[model samples]
Target: MDVAASPTSGPATPAGPDSAWMLREAEQFIELFYGEGNGQGGPAARMAEIRAEVAGTGTYTHTVDELAFGARVAWRNSNRCIGRLYWRSLWVRDRRDISDAAGIGTESVKHLVEAGGGGRIRPTITVFAPDRPDAPGPHIHNEQLIRYAGYPQPDGTVLGDPRNVGVTELALRRGWRGAGTRFDVLPLVIETARDGIELFELPPEAVLEVELSHPRYPWFAGLGLRWHAVPVISAMNLEIGGIRYPAAPFNGWYMGTEIGARNLGDTDRYDLLPVVAAKMALDTSSNATLWRDRALVELNVAVLHSFDRAGVKITDHHTESNRFITHLEREEEAGRTCPTDWSWIVPPVSGSATLVFHRYYDDADLRPNYLRRECPVEGGPDRT
Candidate 1:
């Protein structure tokens, strides 16, 4: 974070819950999204009211407009995000009232159906219950509403995403068994220490998964690899207006490498590089062989090709990188400093191939953003 430019410059970090920081963040967000006054004597008046309330014993309630604008700017301020080009278009569903497990479960299913938009996946977020001064909020224990089960065997190999092995084990312990496939939707575990836990098995109809297949290789489909249509990250907490929504799940469209390079290709996760390399008959005897790289390219090709064939909305790394530059230029024109993580802006695959790899950015962590919190589920840890 640039200290000289921040309203809360005295603090080295910006993660603390300070009323002044919250108000300043809110003012900047509202002014950028909805110009001053909006017929209400501008953000200045709104900030005055918020300031008095924060200083006093009472809590301030952000207007619906304020809430909507906060959600949008949260995306814009996400330093690790590359899809900020469409940050202004995020469809924010205010579900802060539904606190129960069953209700949130139903709403989550609806979220998938609506966000997926039948494969025309829309960038969306569903803000669930928020934390209060007296109490905590409802939370989603899974990283995403739709993710696969990880079954670890004694042979030291994982059948699915090893990163989710703990969650899968918990799900199985809770009687939510899987079919042992590479793509199985882990039950949506929603809970709070006060409200208790409830396991929700997402209806197969609600989850739209596309089968992976290369355009040139028909055998790819037989490998039985698939991915969900929508990636609704339900685990992270959304902090805005000095209030934290512990279960505000947000999502953007996926870049092919998220699946091909990290999820599927990472050695600790699916670890399919060796399998893919063997499938293409590439030599893996040494690092000089470049077998991993060669195999990953085709795997990414399969991912892109499959998503395109299935009519699912998936962005390629190159296109998304260009879009990030466009977002940066727009933010600059609006007199906004675009806080970004250089490593994240670069694509997982072909880092040097994107224009974003050639630039440095202000690395300030901003407000109304998401955070990964640690809270234990009723039966397990909230690893997600």
Candidate 2:
């Protein structure tokens, strides 16, 4: 159920009335994704054209990366008939090579322009590039800054003193605690290689991490952000070719799962924890309408497995698996329904899985900070 998939299999052909309707819808999806063919033939014809283009050259390159982000983030800006306000951050880097493009581009990028009327636009994004050291090679060492601006035009033009746009001068600002934390905010990073995008590498001991959230789920406290907790539950050490690759933390601001209902509530600070480290927990607080009511939940539990002691190089790899279990009981409460209990075994490179519970908390308007609410039968925090 991964929402992002290459829509290129089977008879997605537009035939018959029903098939034609589906074909039209599918083509529209393709148009939004490629950002071409604004001139209609419906969506089907455009998709067929794109399919043919890739088949001809065996390369499917896009300026905006993926179709979803371009549609949701980029297209809306250009399709003004929607009458919605739009914003985007144009990031730059010092250098890039095409061969190392792994997870570059996203489904959340957009192109926007506003003219006439007293208009206010904010272009807030994180820009990262290799830090200069005499000469710059692909060391992967770079500097990033969170940029915010009040107004602007489409072809990367700006109005008034951009500083007056209210952007904090410090490149690395933290939020509430680190609202001003000074890291980059781009969703995914990419570089150009031979003819396509590739993943860049960090030069030896120089590691960098940043927290990025969906603009719609800004503050980080509410459940909107909590959904990312799934990665914590999904993390499993992988040993490939005698090398042990540690599970990379879930690094995005919004919850990164492909299953279940989409969380539509405003996010508070407590909900945004998964983007930083790899693990976090939530307090249902016995609210049936809130946590209990959702059709599904993504839990981030640490998995113990065996693999090579060395790490595996991550390329354009996205591994996914699903499990279905019925009965779960809350440990703290003798009578309450508990969460599901499942485990993933390690390969030879690693051994035994451990379940580490890291709870998510809200510290924004704290007269008294909220702690993890305990289950009925057991006490909180330090439960055995």
Candidate 3:
């Protein structure tokens, strides 16, 4: 059974027998992950070895190549993710041997730095230790490696990202003293079944952030808008076949809406819509005048322009939407059905303006998918 990691404490394990389903999943993953070029021996020999390992008392360790391929395929099978077109490009780091909290924190910085790519953000994933036959795997309590803190002010308004207010409160209760700033990066929380939990402060070099600015409007830089360069999702379960790896973290270059539309413009987030709109001298009298929409477009323009000027890797919704169609066509040629969630695939700001908005997509979980797990928090599963 999968373990639930809480923000307040360590993870809890629910014991379950190793069943035939796990073996079947392992077999499926081995076949799919290895493909034609398996190992030095052969695919048949490798499959036999995997089967023996699964059937035996000791746990099986995936070959280096298997780990890499499995991670890439997991990205490919993520139906809710609109960025699967570049799934094959994922760089996977196999850290299955690491179980200590300190090791995870140290290596996670490497994960961040490598994924940062010195401004050219890369799509990457790191596979940590898997849940063993007797115990649960170590878990990352933070939703992401880098996230802005939310400080609840006396006026009942959050001083930072409002969406993270609850988690920030939990962190404070757990002895995390934030800088009380709008963009304070949260500390790394690692919860283990054996050692309980520990905390690690992120080093300065591990985080690559960009200051937001407009190309023409100099005042936009004065708004003090900025965002982290990479989004390292740290809480998803990487399911290859039937095996679940709870501590695996992955990342990708951010889409423009992820910054401009939702993170900054959302009402509960930074809520910069009214602020940006007023600065642009747009009519704030009513919603019918499209002032909010116009402001949103300009905000997105600043995001794209800033990232571009900084030499970071980012894709616009229109370009990515067209690429999704291209991905579908390629999948069709390969006789594979492409599973997509329309609500997420469409751009948050300009849903009707994008091509992905007008299409119907089949919802399917083919294989080797990354699954969203229910966190210990009460408000359902947390997104990383």
Candidate 4:
């Protein structure tokens, strides 16, 4: 319900049944959210208690405000969720012709709605729930899309709980890509392999696909990053650890598109999502053999799925490691040298996996060459 301020100056106290009911409602709401078997208290009953307590304190007039605050606290506490979605847009401002940019925010979101190919993004919202069964061709741009993130509150606001980061800052960091005021909205998608918690995007398009492989039997231990076209630069590429990786070809699983126009005449506004795919790397300090001390490589790829200029379909993409491996394999087949003992560090929270580097070659004269020496060096064993 839309919250409204009360006319009375002082707070109003809740009565016997009234106060009890409110508390019950709150508790029930919590139950529906976190799902059953989550070990949380019942929703209907809990709301009653909160109502009675507030009434006893004589702060009933502020019920609306309290309810809003309580709802947020309730959601955060029970859901274990964080983050938000944001949006803004750039348009040529002919101050001489029109002096307002009131509809830009609405328009930006509209584009994503019409595009409509970002998985369950546009269709599953509660607002659009009724129209689902027999709805004719795409009706009123569905506004039901939900956004979530790792952090619930903003930076200045305290997030005493450390499960996630500040929602506002995450939104702003990405929202800056869009011009004008930022809205608190997020995309609804869950990255698997990682916990199936709903993820939030700062006004992302539709589908974001991120993959990080370590080239080993258990391949979940690498750190890689992925990107779709932001609202700025036309084409983009990624360079990490002195290695350059190619963008997904023809937008394979993750398509490509034209970066959006610039804002404030900066010509540098681009939109993209950068996620730190959490994972734990191998711990080798305990052993003394080469296998024990080998450095672990970590790869994380996060795709901030959103919309392209055309607003026709959801974009898809893969992380850099896959692209790098494809290139490395080709080079080896051509008798070119490559690196060895490659390892990745997957964060512990997200689970663990490993990437093994097997093939070794030698070609010191070539640029960007990482060859493994076969014979020992002047003072020690071969260290190519």
Error of 4 at 377 (Å): 45
Model 4 Cα lDDT, one tens digit per residue, 1-384: 000000001111122324344444444444433342332465455445545755685212212323233222221121101100100111111111111122222332443333234432221110111011122111111011221122333454322112112332333454422122222233322111223222233245432322323333242323322222211110111111111111100011112211111110111211111111113344434455332113221221112222322233332212222333464466468553443222211111111221212333231221111111111111111100
Cα lDDT of model 1 by residue, 113-133, tens digit: 998888888877788776654
lDDT of 2 by residue, 1-384 (tens): 111110111121121223334334434445544453344455465566656644464322322333223322321221111111121231211112212323222111211111000112222221112112122111111111111112333774333213212222221122211122212121122323232322232221122222223222233323322111111100111111111111111111111222122221112112222332222233444555344223122222110000011121111111211111111111123332222112111111111221111222111211001112212111111100
Residue 129 local lDDT, model 4: 10
User: Which wins on lDDT, candidate 2 or candidate 3?
Assistant: 3
Instruction: Work out the TM-score per prediction.
Output: 0.88, 0.21, 0.91, 0.20
Residue 357, model 3: lDDT of 92
Better of 1 and 2 by lDDT: 1
Q: Give the better candidate number (1 or 4) by lDDT.
A: 1
Candidate 4 C-alpha error for residue 364, in Å: 10
RMSD in order of candidates: 4.9, 22.5, 4.6, 26.7
Per-residue accuracy of model 3 over 152-206 as CA lDDT, tens digit each: 8888898887767666776777898988789988787788888886778898899
Backbone clash pairs for candidate 3 read none
True-vs-predicted CA distance for residue 224, candidate 3, Å: 0.8
Task: Give the poorly placed runs of model 3, Cα more than 4 Å off.
Answer: 1-17, 34-44, 378-384
After superposition, candidate 4 runs with Cα above 4 Å error: 1-148, 152-167, 170-327, 335-341, 345-384
Count of backbone collisions in candidate 1: 1
